[model samples]
Target: MNFLIRTNWWKWLTMFLLTYTVVGGLLFTVPRLPILNETIRNLHFHVPMWFGMIILFAFSVFHSVKYLSSKDLVQDLFSKELINVGVLFGILGIITGMIWANFTWGEPWSNDPKQNAAAVALLIYFAYMILRGSLSDDHQKARISAIYNIFAFAVLIPLLFILPRLTDSLHPGSGGNPGFNAYDLDSNLRLVFYPAVVGWTFLGSWIAGIMIRVSLYQFKKDSE
Candidate 1:
């Protein structure tokens, strides 16, 4: 028990679990006011999932940059793990957003710029994984994958944020502007929402780290 507790993986897992519990508990206890009511509840899950997805993708791109500059195999491994986790969060975010939209907007999906952009972003990442698999050699695979990851992120910026703002969306701040800025979110919502984002982002990273460690262990065992 002592040995397990001392491990870095265990420490991260413990922290992630504790944070999740605290955030979930607080969200549950908070009274739903008239202004936000049910939409506010969506914040406890939807917004956090998007934040987690962004964090994972950011790390994936960072490692891709590192791999290009340093040619490190470990960086390549980290990039792959980050993408795997990012994709999971991205899918969750989309599903949750779809549910939220159905309640708030009267439809499960609108051609809303945000929705379209999010779908495009997911497809781009999927293409990245496909590009990695197409390569036969390890070194070549790492190099090409890193390049594709960087490009995927570059494309993601516009798809997720920029393009969404250019067109009108049935979603918030759609018709003439982007939403969720300083003026859009009230103080009460920010209280629980911000912490939720942090907690979920940490949880996402924790999962990715565990996956990376497990992959390393398996690789070592196979090599031996």
Candidate 2:
């Protein structure tokens, strides 16, 4: 037990500090601000969680392309693992956003462009997974999954970011809603936000690594 704990100490420490920093930053910063009050605390978890989710999904798409180009099973495994982690983060983001919305907007969900766009993006990736499962042949599955991943990413760009900006939204930065621009965030917020993004991303990658290792082990055992 001691050896196991020692082996994983750094990851555990990093996660602990990440949690502490996020909570501390929110507690210190949000309460003192006039406009934000208690509601601003949500920013610490919600924004970074979504940002990490997007990053993981982007990595999954990249690995899917690599697998298609090289016909490497390892890349395919990595891609699938990344997709799993990305979905987890996506769910967390949705839950956090819903909580924030309920408190701030008096509703759990609104037909905001950003919200709808994010939902569509999630559905698109979910469809990619379904497409992969429908195929039986390994090579066919890899090829089809790769193509679908690429297509999903193409749609993701406009759905999550561009379309949200183009139309009116009940959420921030749309339809004259009060929102953060480049100038709106404080330096302190940036300090925590950047680390939160990096930490969550690394954590996702760590999870993907574990999944890939487990898959490899199972494959070896089955072959033996």
Top candidate when judged by lDDT against the true structure = 1
Q: All candidates' lDDT scores?
A: 0.75, 0.74
Off by over 4 Å in 1: 1-36, 175-178, 181-184
Instruction: Give TM-scores for every candidate, taking all chains together and pairing residue i with residue i.
Output: 0.83, 0.86
Report clashes for each candidate as comma-separated counts.
Answer: 0, 0
Task: Give per-residue CA lDDT, model 1, range 1-224, as digits (tens).
Answer: 11321357755654765476455634554545444455756766776777788888888888888889999877888889989999999899899889878877778898877888888888988998898889988779999999888887888887787777776666655655445662256666566666667667777777887788877787678668
Model 1 lDDT-worst window of ten:
1-10
How far does residue 61 in candidate 1 sit from its true spot (Å)?
1.3
Best by the TM-score measure = 2
Q: Per-residue lDDT of 1-224 in model 2, one digit per residue for the tens? A: 11222266557756975887667656666434544457666776787777878888888888888888899876777777788888888888888989888987889898877788778878887888898889998778888888888788888887787778778665654654335552256776666666766677667767766777787688678668
